[model samples]
Target: MNPIDDMDADPIDVASHWCLQLADGRLQGDALARFQTWLDEDPRHRAAFDTVARTWQAFDASPAAPSLMAMREEALSHYARRQSRRWRRPAGMRRPMLAAVAACLLLAVAGWGWIQAQPDVYRTGLGERQLVRLDDGSQLSLDADTQVEVRYNHDRRQLVLRQGRARFQVMRDPLRPFSVSAGDRTVVATGTEFSVELLAAQVHVVLYEGSVDVLPRDAATSPPPSASPPSPSTVHRAREMRLVPGQELVAGIDAADARIREVDAPRTRGWESGQLSFNDEPLGQAIERMNRYAGSHVLATGDVPSASLRISGTFTAGDNEAFVEGITGVFPVTVREEGPRYVFVQRPGTSTPEEKMTTQ
Candidate 1:
């Protein structure tokens, strides 16, 4: 066999080879250390290894696993007999060849099964809050009109948020990182509780407990400017930011106006329990959010000045009437029914001098 073939293979292919070796349950001492060192050598190596692990884990979850394992045992015995008869083959080469054969046996049995074992897609209707429990004991709480696709492999747990908001309570797995992709950013964690919301071009992240790293989608693929890349240990060298508990990171998909700031973590998740809390949020923005859970459309009209005013309060979701009444009590505006929509307009004769000047 040409040694150059193995050297030229991608890390993912190499990682799969290593996975097969470990599955044979024969490696000890030096072999194990070398595997660990290879994992630590590069982030791509770990990612590749995780992909192989995911495929294996998916097989374990399949109903055909038991029968497949039985076949694998039979194949191992048959291969052992064949190898015993080849006396001219070097002893050192025999074991390595046997390992490769064992992996092929598994692939033959479950190649299609592995692809079918990908995670399920979940969605919630408007104004609905649904909770989902994953196979790995992790919990996902999806907010109104939300969509998420979940996939767990032996090496990593991943979720893709297509839109809306969701809270994640991830179980701890040191070897396999948990990541959620939204817009142009990926939020990675080991074990933590957090919430993510997609608004316009922004991916809003709130870390309630533990820690998470917000990274650009291409952070793993793009190498640095220099000829040599940074070591895997220097994870911070990538264009990423680590967020601690009680912090918020808003990443812009356009790569502009991204910001990290502190917030009341409890208030951020209040929507999960039917409580909507806003802290000095703009009236227009607040109304748009509340409309997510509302049946009757609330429209801003007449005086645009009041739309930019800051408002703060806690109200129940779907209670648009109460919210409008509350706003009118404090602000110089009134809510009136116009067909199917409730329009907020400036109160008659209440326009400020600045507003009048601007209008003229």
Candidate 2:
């Protein structure tokens, strides 16, 4: 069989080979044209190339490039010595050596393939985030302190969001359905780009592209209540809430009706760029978001009207001090230390407590 057959069978492996060739800076004329043809032949080719390019860009931007380059050089030199000795080995040994080399190359280019081939749990620590590309071409961007359990089968793809938020870009698969379960709520889609956030007692689903059906697990089994409600049967039916692009569905704990609203999808994912954007968001809710990135906690205190006031701005994630300063600067509020937690209340002369010490 031709060596190129292996590459033709797996586009990501081929993309990795081409990426290495491009790194050598020797691709020209006919070679570049052939590469372009390969990319244009299939959509998977372009996706693989984009993934490889992003990996290269990340490596270039990282501070550990020097040590990583040194490791690469050492690995290459060792491989060269092995190649020189391989020809002298027995015929049986030669096949194993070639297979080992192929496996190593595949492992290098598509590490995520091996990871997603089996059931796996991916998680991120406090203030940390992760980008994961699954074997089916779906990508998951997990936010800080998030945990997800992934299980893929021939029939369907399933993910359980144990905690925190995640942005999912799912590839279309007609035969298999993709679903994410957060608490009792499950958001199902064939192919879509969306985000699911699990808060203390709420599950927020934001759709950036395509459509998804957000339903409760016990929707079908439960009957509609007899009380004189505004929407009689909407709450009992789970498939009622279908989200399109730029639409968000907020499902509160034990709440019959979910609130659906329009939002700026890009701004909703500002955490991906290490920033947070709020557009007239509640002060309490804003503080809770900041707390997700900060080790220290901040809470709203007293019957302060400012706690429910609308706040709008962008701030760097994990900068608790700057967030407090911004709050005091704009809203009529003051920050005070209450043991381990920071309390936000209405400014002095009100019923709320006076500021003991300012953050900044």
Candidate 3:
């Protein structure tokens, strides 16, 4: 019998019935509307539903879930046999008794699930990208050579970016703030679109929409006594910095300070579409971004003074030849082919025979 049919049924029973119906994807159309009406009929209805949902989530996440489920099925089977052999209880009594048994079993299973929920790890190889849809409806877009680990529980949603870059479309859950930790910094948001990149010794955060707080991962801890007092800029870097849309924050890994500036946020995610946009970005950094997609790396020797020179433009990712041509065309740089690798060097004052012939 449907638990909802009994108007006198316990709210938990009704809620559990609704949860099962929803989990099986059977509630739709008028039935879904009826469920909504029931939820709104009493404040207790929503609370009961949330409780049952959380309990089920916990139970499912338990490491011993399969064994517990098997035990539950066996107990239910034994109960059914005993009921068949004895005098039948009234329908009202039967429903409540069954609910009590199920509730007890769920509570027992939940104890194990609540202790730990396994984290999910995601990674992308060189020249590959990945899109992930989390259980809470948040989305993650990972760039090539990226890795992240995700862990979700009733109290919080947490992720750690071990390397590379990723864009996040976070779901709003005030009860559970979403946080991503990259290096020494952590980005916290409720509902926002942003990207975090771990580039060499720097961590870059770009906020495209909504707001976020970038703070030190261990803000509560004090530095050791042997350490010198921080500079004013370092003090500012240690405090939480709130970011609005279209702003970017760059924090150095080993340094004590950070920089925040306005940026074209949308253009920063151009790598998602195979287009890399650089706006007065250092040539060394641009080469690093390009190398994520290139099979043969493009190297700039330390002697190449132009390596620190800034370049600006959009270029196709992985097209190393085109990037080389573009760099040589504008900056005082020239390319030398070394097997599969391309090396950039400072251009000579006089044109070489090959350069003169090509120009002619």
Candidate 4:
């Protein structure tokens, strides 16, 4: 019987069947095609198969595996003997049944092992980038000066962006949604691509593909406060927002301010390629991002209204000199060398940069 035809069969059982066939080098040609079709038909199929395959590989290295195998054989033999007397089944049919039983036993052991596993932490230093391939086939691209903690179990896959930024290309697991928590907000996804940045006073979420729900982390899990009724602003701050591709959502870390706007999603990922692309971004925020890659930090000082100055351009990640020149050339801003740091101040006898630039 074709395995795929058994639609009512347990997914784990089908996965175990494929694992066994592949392990003994039985899947080839048409059998390989069928396996691929089944895998692509549902995300859960691939997830189950990965779990079973990992368990099969781990079995050889386990110290108690020999004793466990002995116990399984002893039990199978006793069952086979009882079955032979009752139904007198053919030996050929019994062997397949015995193998399926063994696979389920192995899966049970794998589940216990997964529950005992510890969370993994990944970090990147200043001006460094790291690409991490998770066990479940998801990929994480960490930007400079970033730290993330990944915890995966049978129930869910969770990550915390401790600092900085990272992009996630999540693998689809219908039973387990992927979630990344940054500050008080959490971005939840299922088989999607998105980036989450923990800024100084805001959490920025940019969705590149699929959709994500940005919500307060405690809203769903924590019990409602009983001491006093929350103000309207407090309730509004805790409200969830859904983001689609090409949309950017910025939520305040210390304030109840949140806003969403259309953005060039691809431009937001320029940092992954050692490029910083900004589209009318605040000068201070852009400078903060540049400092992540700079040996000498850039500081906005003096009577310069840096907050009101917006910059638009693309610059190399670590090119501090070029960034300084770019701003000085366009805006009425002067760069003063102060040891290793560069201080930006308003040029003498010049109008505000934004007003001057707008007039031109």
Candidate 5:
């Protein structure tokens, strides 16, 4: 095998390969140490590793984890299952590792029962977001600390945004309307582009491409405690708010206001382009957005007056350390690395207004 294939691969791909190698117990001593050192050298490395780590952890936590791992040791078992050509087809990605894992998931689970089963979950942890392209060519971008369950069937495509935020680009399929359930209501769409941010206290929706229906799932909806809980309450709109392209809707089950606004959808949904921009956005909002692209913990403590005391700029989240530094520069804050656990944000006084005015 080519030892340096990694050098030419995308950095994230290389990181994912390193993680897979580590998980397979292939690296040891110096090589492993070097990988570890490289991972620690930059915030982006940590973010990439963490992405795979969390996915692996989630897979491990599932009921089928053990069986999947067991297949790794079996001799030509996955191959034999594939050669059971009488069955017509088997599960597995074409890639070797993926093929093995996929075949194991199928065989160990007693064959072809859970096809594309929303992974039992699809999630993004704190300071991370992931974009997954569905089999139907629709795009789904998950926001930080998000968990959702997807059940796409012949009749309809359904998603339960259990927590966090997500942007969806639906493929044109009039037969199977796409629906998202959050808070008390469900956002139903047809060949449309939209996003949903399911929060503990509220929910927000933005429309980009096509039209979507916003209605309640349950009558007396309860706010989500967090994003990962199974089957949270629904959110119903007291009034119908039609949002065309470039429109945004904010729904709060607990609060009195659930309104849709005319805003720049591109600016709000800019993570897809690998660029995150803040325009007089609150410290909390900026931190929330930053956390999506980087594995860092940022908070504003000690008398955060209001959202107007905001920061504005554009930065690539793939470069987390610089992103955080660029952000903290506007504030009277210091950024420090904390032993792979967190990135601390300490404010000396208050962020300066003049500093906030600097354009990126």
Candidate 6:
């Protein structure tokens, strides 16, 4: 019986094998075309790819995940060595028994290589900013105080956001697309520029130029009909959304709902200009931004939070303590330093802090 046709072989195993083969950069012409066809032939191909992608993301967080592609290549090379070594083991008086040993050798080769060549290369520490030039000549601007890992090879160019936000200006390559993984979806692009921010419970993508194709991680994991009901076609899964400049798409924490809208993105990106901008930003959000950017603690826990507020201002980068005091001047607040952070209180006579306010 052909090894490829063995009924006991797991579909996941086959998919992983194919993913390795595709990522190995050896397939060409008909062989490559056939692999592509196979990937599109069944849903399992996609599921395997997703697993590979998630594994890639998990590896980004792990010290050993970054070098996975290299390890896979090494493992394949060793498997070939194992195959070559198999025939050299005497005349093989026990043919059937020897085949099992040969298979074991190959498995051992792959497994040991995988274990030993684990990835653990890249990482960013808190309050760190990283700038990376992608394989396609695009630029990645990592936001302050975040971490991420990258794997760019012949087959796939991927970035896993471990924390914080990043702005990507992707160079175009349809044959080899660029993708960024954050939360439950992956943002795929073709020569487009976009910024993706991963907060505690949300993933936000704001396009500055070009367009991005947002695809959910589970897009291909819909369960196969357990009983083959009358409706035999695949479920109408969510399609990718093309976000243009000034457009933003947000996916909730649980991925229950994804939202897209248009806004003044340039103004939203005021932080890049050494100043954080808010256009009627809520009191809570403004505080969160301050906390994220300030090396010193900046909390909005005073009377400033309970009442409505609206603010539009450009602040200097350093001396956040002074900046908080300046905010009091604009909005009628009394500011004081408690420890290293600033807290705001309503100007005793003014109305209570509004529930909502905008900062621009």
Query: TM-score for every candidate vs. truth?
Result: 0.59, 0.58, 0.61, 0.61, 0.52, 0.56
Clashes of each: 2, 0, 0, 0, 12, 22
Model 2: how far residue 345 lies from native, Å? 3.3
**Model 4 ranges with Cα > 4 A deviation:** 1-118, 220-238, 296-303, 355-360
Ranking by lDDT: 4, 3, 1, 2, 5, 6
lDDT of 2 by residue, 199-226 (tens): 7777888899988877685552232223
TM-score, structure 6 vs. true: 0.56
Candidate closer to the true structure by TM-score (higher is better), 1 or 3: 3
Q: Write model 3 residue lDDT over 1-360, tens digit each, in one string.
A: 455876866676677666556544566778777887998899999888776656555555672687756654554454444444433543233556655656654653343244245578999988899999998999999998899999987678889999999999999998888899999888888899999999877899999988888778875122212333222222244466777788788888866677778888778999999888887666777778888888565555434544356768888878877888887876666777877678877677833222210110
- Per-residue lDDT value at 109 in model 5: 30
RMSD of each: 13.4, 13.5, 9.4, 10.4, 16.7, 12.9
Candidate ranking (TM-score, best to worst): 4, 3, 1, 2, 6, 5
Candidate 1 lDDT over 1-360, as tens digits, reads 211134555675556556555555533567666777877878988787676555455454662687756644454455455344443443333656655665553552254244437568999877898999998899999988889999887688879999888999999997878889898888888899999887665688889998787778767333212323222212233476777787788766757445677788988899999888776656766676687787666555445564366767788888888887787766677877888678887778886312110100
Residue 195 alpha-carbon offset, candidate 1, angstroms: 0.6
- Over 1-360, each residue of candidate 4 has an lDDT whose tens digit, in order, gives 334466766566677566556545566779877887898889999887776555454653562687656755665565455444444565433678887756654654454345347568999988999999998999999999999999986768889999999999999997888899998888888799999999887788899998777778775343223332222212245466677788887887956666777788888999999998877667777787888887566555456676678777788998888888777887888988877789888888987766322111
lDDT of 1 at 260: 71
Tell me how candidate 5 scores on lDDT: 0.61
1-360 in candidate 6: lDDT tens per residue? 221344454444554454455445444577656656766877876576455544434434452454764643443344334434443544323445433433443443344345335532344443455677754687888766566667665655677777777888888887666788788877877688888877766788888887677777555222212221112122223445556678778776556567677668887676565566655545555565556566666566575663266555655444467557656656767776788767777777787654332333
Q: Candidate 3 regions off by >4 Å?
A: 1-118, 220-238, 295-302, 305-307, 348-360
